[model samples]
Target: MSPVFAHGQLRLYLLSLLNEGPRHGYEIMRDLEQRFNGLYTPSAGTVYPRLAKLEEEGLVSRGDDGRKVTYTITDAGRAEVARRQADLGDLEDDLDRSASQLADEVRSRVKGEAADLRAELKAAAQEARRVAQPATGEPMSGRARGEFEQAINELRQSARSILRSRKTAESVRAEALRIVHEAKRQLDQLK
Candidate 1:
């Protein structure tokens, strides 16, 4: 459910959208998705049914554009749009607020998660160096240094792969935590 369309707002907004010009179902869906900054996308199941209902209500007329159905607002629909001018304004404001809030939340979470991952990686690198260095103050053997570097490189590549994938902030955070815990467990077992 979209925070932008809480009640019958979607219906009115759809009518308003048609008032602008005749649009195909996909166009309407794309416009809505763009309006919400890609945060909310209405599926075909959600959009087509509402368009069918609007046609049934005589508020909109449907025409065939090649194989596609395009919706155009009727006089009644225009009247409805004019009648609910204030509602349209309110809906626009709500959309603006919702999009801004979602963007801010994503930005904040990404920053925090990146910082946490950086700290964990730094700590792990420091620990690896400490372990590689012997207590006798002797320099680390070539084999020990190579192993440590390989492990750190693998960890860095894994983190990069995870971050590059598309996922919600919560899921990314959870996965990062799990990876960190698993790394710690493996390091402990090596003791």
Candidate 2:
């Protein structure tokens, strides 16, 4: 699961790294691991394909340096990097929130309550957290049911909060419904 996120992060990091100057693929990978505190290291199999995609998208241009692929970001690539920079938080926030969410759920569920409820909730939460987080420091990504549910829950809570603040019941319902529609769009992206 984390491979997908790593792939995306690697592409962005390469773009950012090459902004300093054109660099070979190995240099970009080394720079990414350094920046991430050795948290992520992409295999050649992963990095090359994404580089190919970037080249295909015209975000990257390659210079011949013997057998090495030296990549320079094009004007279009620069624009995409900028656009992604703007939407970057939306992508990043999911991983960020997922981490804190596990701790928060653990804290809440472990608090005083009925024994069965505590035990059951704790076990379920633990399993979910384990599934969400990778053994390595890299985060889990890819289209999966867990992420879809989390996104839906986020939208549902957003809607409920919006609904709560409204003065009229009709407005509240309308706003919540709008949020639900937005949630569906988010889910569709996973597919």
TM match of model 1 to true structure: 0.65
Q: Top TM-score: which candidate number?
A: 1
Give every collision pair in model 1.
none
Model 1 poorest 10 in a row by lDDT: 165-174
Name model 1 segments beyond 4 Å from true.
Answer: 127-158, 161-163, 167-191
Candidate 2 per-residue lDDT over residues 64-168, each given as its tens digit: 878987999999888777878755565556445544554454344334222333343334344444455444667556654576466446545545554565322
Pick the lDDT winner. Answer: 1
Q: Kindly give the number of clashing pairs for every candidate.
A: 0, 0
Clash pairs, model 2 backbone: none
